[model samples]
Target chain A: MTTLMNRQYYLASRPAGAPDSSNVPARDVPVPEPADGEVVLKNLYISLDPAIRGWMGDDPNYIEPIALGDAVRSSVIGRVVKSDSPDFAEGDVAMTVGAWEAYTRVPGVMLNKLDEAAGIPLSTYLGVLGPTGLTAYFGLLDVGRPKAGDTVLVSAAAGAVGSVVGQIAKMQGCRVVGMAGTDDKCRWLEEDLGFDAVINYKQCGDYEAAIRVACPKGVDVYFDNVGGEIFDAALLCLNKFARVAVCGWISTYNVPDAPGPTNLWQLVAESVTVQGFTVIDYMDRFPEGIAQLAEWVVAGKLQFREEIVDGLDNILPTFLRLFDGSNQGKLVIRIPEE
Target chain B: MTTLMNRQYYLASRPAGAPDSSNVPARDVPVPEPADGEVVLKNLYISLDPAIRGWMGDDPNYIEPIALGDAVRSSVIGRVVKSDSPDFAEGDVAMTVGAWEAYTRVPGVMLNKLDEAAGIPLSTYLGVLGPTGLTAYFGLLDVGRPKAGDTVLVSAAAGAVGSVVGQIAKMQGCRVVGMAGTDDKCRWLEEDLGFDAVINYKQCGDYEAAIRVACPKGVDVYFDNVGGEIFDAALLCLNKFARVAVCGWISTYNVPDAPGPTNLWQLVAESVTVQGFTVIDYMDRFPEGIAQLAEWVVAGKLQFREEIVDGLDNILPTFLRLFDGSNQGKLVIRIPEE
Candidate 1:
């Protein structure tokens, strides 16, 4: 028996700077067949993250850049249509990269078979239980090295990575301060996530003053996802021997030129250490992170939130939400069944 | 019968910016008597380093500031006049932090007894076997860590510290390049000190081009003493995982407002590590450094140079040479007997 496939999204042209709807052209292509050691997956949910901006360019990074006119790269939860590999069979759910399309072929070694009958939602695998959660886990523990009673400051605190980072810091017995673009997100962090303090950066004209109030003792460990004025403000208020893990510079990726921080001299005065890292550096211990995140979710010690939009057509607009700070939590695209 | 005491110089007033002869008022002070565990020494030769600027300012540092109306602070080598302590007698030569004057009363604990009769000149103890040598030793070993055949670059190479640093890198089996302000200094470094290559930055309109010619394999370790445009150029040509040991920033110390580098993003791109350190941080390993340096000198593996200016009255002018690159090698002031 044959099955019909929906339209797939392929890369049309490489972007010079910020990517828009026109930069990524969508087209229909034949569904791929599962050869030996391969499985054909019908993508159900795709994860859109800020890291995609780096993949769009031909820069050197941990992951390979997707070539122009190739299918846009993403992580997706999908159901197997056919499996030529021994590890998977037809109708088995799998998690793999390149979930931006309706159907993708993944190798058996790379696919993680999931039990769809389980009570947990599918989008959770793309978020708190997947790459984002693992990033927050290793970045906070190995890089930042937060301790009990230490002050932890996280930028973009209400977003996917930041929200999880605050809760983990709180769980580790730290005084957490979350900086978000809106009052509602800040309020949610304080009220729902048990954060010690929250600052709506949009309302405050002086970010350093806001940080002074939010973090009275000064920041010990800073997980920097957004790198712009907030980064400079945080850098100014860092305590002696502070550790800054630069996971992503989402703030500068869109701009043609990157701006300089005027207060970089503060690093010398405080003996601060700043490091830029990608999640691939911690891939060896990814399972430990996923298991711990799962245990936290089941024990009610951690909460996961998602803003799911219907249809594959909405992926571009949903991805743009990351730059505008519109989404409260992890953003996902739920593809309709063909 | 009491003999006439030697004359000394006192701080007349703090300068707004660059120090001058008017800033130090020459005066005749009564030679101080040695108390218990103390030795009164007749100042023979004293090192006039750039660090004196830090002592003259009211800013906090590792050591105490020089107060107005008090004798200026410096590192000096002298002969003991009378010792109340068991460590030394009337004729023992010693090195202590007492430059700036004809006679200095130093605690015995702070004095390192020197043997002027040893085959080497007493002035060498103030250059290659003193704090300058220690700075170069630790800055290279602990910070730069140059590997065999690696390209090592030293700024202000003909100066006391840079000369030893480049020689040490050569001894470690690395390709050494020295950057000096004058053609004569560059010739001296290449001919006398065994540097693989030398660049006279004053003559070279394009330093990066000179660096490319001198260092065909690119710079792996950059020992930076002169900071400003020289530092900015080095940062651009640093290899991946390069180490920059910032021993001093002499270029910016005299300027009222120092301009920051525009190419700092290169640091992030190349994953370069820049560390600032002081000689005091390696007090425990001073003996090891001095021993190795002395052995190198005795074996003809290392050479020492001193630029001596006679009379304590010339201290201000001699000291000013460091800022203008007028003095070659270590600048020392030789005081006359009373």
Candidate 2:
């Protein structure tokens, strides 16, 4: 058998602000054989998340920063090419926290075997049916805790996590208002995703006014994905005892000197609850989340979209699209068939 | 019966910044007669709290703003001079949400009869055994949720709510760090309040460094009463899954253009929970809080202090002392004996 080479991206240096080619560069290395209790995965899809920008920063955060010369950390959907553990077999599709690479050698313990018979695309696992779905599930339902007739406002509403958040809030009998970057995205959120109202934030000059018009009764639960100005506007419109789930702050992820919400005192004035969470914290309950999310999808209550990039070569540019608000839904790269 | 005149302070105009004589002015009117189900309360001890500043503002808040020409809202301990309801009788001491006045016509339903034989000062009911104590109890225990090994940091540590918060956190077997304005206050917190560490924020120019030295293990629970810089500093020292009880923002109460915390994203990075609450929201649990606090006070496990200003004539100046950090503990104006 001929030796195969694996192309991967590594953290060359910590970026000052937004990452570019200079900070994260690609390198080629020979694919390694699966050792005992490990599996050799042929990566098919790599998730490009706004969270990647946070992991690239040198500051202390929810998880350890990616060390210099290390393969950039990411979540990937891959097929096992070789397995030396009882948990996984060759040709099995699995999901794991892997690297931005064409092939990865992962510990069998880290892998969650995918059900190819589930009839959903494997990429959905990385979007609505995987961690992204779990984030929207637990953050909105558990953290936000919306009641029927409650007004739920979501930012970055057309994106993967926000889209799922709006749908789940709707399923819970809430009046959902979403804010997205483009008119097209807002239309999709309203006309297609069943959002009660949508605000194209890029065109809406006064977000507070737009929010007031959309949510006349005031927002009872704010599912914030894009922080900063939008967050401040939402704070002004919060009803008494409102809940704000501090999901990803995608807008400020790249800006090192991002300003915080000035209206945070509203949290006190309105008796609001603002909680920040990561999906990893709920790892023990993953089975429950996955099962529930699957049921929602199967019942036609939850819908999702994927903006799939064609190749690993376009990873850096595709990742940048997350910050620019260019990519809709869950941004992922489909690797070249080997 | 001889006619009695009532002396009161009214909200003349909404202050552009900090309130002064022009905004909150004094007036004299005839003492109101008790209507059906009402009692005429001769205000004796008036409680001065930082929350009063929020009420003076024209903007919407937890409670309705003090409308112009309305008696400035306050919590008062008084003796019922006249009663038209069976719930109250002449000469009975009670606590009620009244006004900055010599006499208030209050609904008997709103008055809580105080036990004169409880062996605690009637004014203590305005402090440790009243709304102040209840605020600390519920805000710390219910919102902060400190574990035994947690590092609890409290701002305005020598003041009413903060002082009680520190003592109770200590009772819960947590290490407590306090931040106060003056060295004397810090000393009082460390020497008397059982705080493990204290930072005199006035002298500690670099609050973040001081917090690092005080709470080496990182803050697990932050009971923030004084917002602005001290609050921002505490945010930087938060441990994973930290809980922040946003009790008040005294520092910004006087400053109309207060800067918001820039490091708020740390809430997301650390998976923190920040909740804002008022004692009013937990009215249903007041009996539990009052009982527990009374037990602690009786068992000598809890201690409190009151800065009493003699005479109703000192009410305005006494209220001003709250924002200036001139009062070491709970500030109360003692009405001269009638």
- The C-alpha lDDT values of all candidates are 0.83, 0.90
Best candidate according to lDDT: 2
Instruction: Tell me the tens digit of each residue's lDDT in model 1 across A1-338.
Output: 47656576766776777787678878887776778799888889999999887778775445667888887899999988888899998888989886578888888889998888988888999899988988888878877899899999999888889899989999999999998999889889999899999888889889999998999999999998888788888988888767776777777667756665655544444546565556676778888898999999999988867999998988887888888899869998998776
Task: Give the per-residue lDDT of model 1 (tens digit) for B213-301.
Answer: 88888899999888788888887777776778877777866774566665554444555666656777789999999999989989999
Alpha-carbon shift of residue B134 in model 1 (angstroms): 2.7
Question: Which digits, one per residue and each the tens of the lDDT, describe model 2 over residues B35-54?
Answer: 88999989989999999889
Record all residue pairs in model 1 with backbone atoms less than 3 Å apart, i.e. clashing: A74-A98
Q: Residue A251's C-alpha lDDT in candidate 1?
A: 79
- Native-to-model Cα distance after best TM-score fit, residue B81 in candidate 2, in Å: 3.0
